[model samples]
Target: MKNNENSDIHLVINIAQQTLILYQHNKKMAQYAVSTAKNGIGSQQDSGCTPLGKHFIAKKIGASEPINTVFIGRVPTGEIYEAKLGMLHPERDWILSRILWLGGVEEGLNKGSNSEGGCDTYQRYIYIHGTPDSEPMGEPLSHGCIRMRNEDIIKLFDQVEAGTSVVIIAH
Candidate 1:
């Protein structure tokens, strides 16, 4: 890995392709298939839809937590997540491995409704997080956050730090 002292990574989520691309100073570092919100991608506060446009990693959660460990409120629940467990709690939104909390940088797009008559979406707690192993990726299937495989998220978590730039492009 070429760790340039100034190597800054950019995470771009393409809603149409259901893919997340990691770039190091405009050069593609890696790309991973992702699963977005089932309701589709949008940026309205509390709309239960993934926000679009420029954002930053406001927080990085689950740094060394074991894979499959359940997380609620960004803290490990001390319970190892299993596919069967998910089946029992079918309504659960499984957030495992790591979490990249996103904050909207655009004013009305995500930060909140603009004074000039636009919607605000940042008040909503949005994230890109790990999902159960059995969950299908490359498909829309989340409340509002982006989902990735546990292993893939772990790898990504290791590569990124807080304040990383993330952009979610609408489909």
Candidate 2:
């Protein structure tokens, strides 16, 4: 492991600041600008908003893929992202590089069936993944996931495991 194996590692994203911090044993290891949801924060199913409270990485995908590699349905699309690619398909929601698929930790809140409200973030297909280089960071501009730069998502994907804790906060 590149990080201290025994140190408790967790990730915290402050929606208000549009930043994410990697913490080890309560000490900040790194900080990066991130883009949350353009629709803002909420837990309703199909809300297209970022969910609040606790979560964990349920799945990690694309460990060896090149940066800017495109993903569809959480599978790499066998194509790398370029400006021309976006121009060709102007409506695709880009999921690139690596993915840390999030699952809700709070019961009946961020996690169950969509009927009552929100069930699981996993069911919602929420992830922290890379976006196009042209997309501005530190802004509320993503559909409903945490969006990072291709380089940053690659770095983060290497540092955390499937069960690592994550907390999303508004401020």
Candidate 3:
């Protein structure tokens, strides 16, 4: 992405508050309640926990799709998420609305490592995406990804572009 592409907007996810703040030109544009990982905060593969520190929107998916559109591996499945679909697959980790695939900015902290303590968040496939309406927000309930409501994620996806800076803070 060009340097100017995301210069005007950025995102900050506060784990403690379970909220994501959108900033444009360094001013708060919007805030949305979110759900983080249920396993808590950590930088480890298979931990099912949210990783901390600075990151960026590595990729943006599901543009032009309707709300509740289902995505698998960032590819639209052509299926819109509804209540019955969720009930049929109760064990599924629904990735709906839009996907803001995240890549870590710091090495050895939240990115880059295939060894004992090197857990790359990008490699972890961590994303900010939408979940079922029946799901609760403002809580730690996801499986490592940051979950948002359908309406909120759609709104956010329209406002931000790829490469936008994203900071996740534990406090």
| Over 4 Å off, model 1 | 1-7, 115-122
Please give the lDDT score at residue 121 for candidate 1. 41
Provide the overall lDDT of each model, using Cα atoms, as 2-decimal numbers: 0.82, 0.90, 0.90
- Choose 1 or 3, whichever is better by lDDT: 3
Q: How would you encode candidate 2's per-residue C-alpha lDDT over 73-109 as one tens digit per residue? A: 9899899999999999999999999999998877777
Summarize candidate 1's per-residue lDDT along 57-108 as a digit string, tens digits.
Answer: 8788888788888998888989889977898998888898888888777777
Question: How many steric overlaps are in each model, in order?
Answer: 3, 2, 0
For candidate 1, the lDDT comes to: 0.82
Q: What is candidate 1's CA lDDT for residue 163? A: 75
Runs of candidate 2 exceeding 4 Å displacement = 1-7
TM-score for each candidate, following the candidate numbering: 0.89, 0.93, 0.94
- The digit string of per-residue lDDT tens for model 3 on 1-171 reads 222344789899999999999999889999999999999998898899999998988888888899899998889999999989988888889999899999997888788974676688889999999999999999899999999999999999998888888999997
Candidate 2 clashing pairs, residues 3+ apart or interchain: 111-119, 112-119
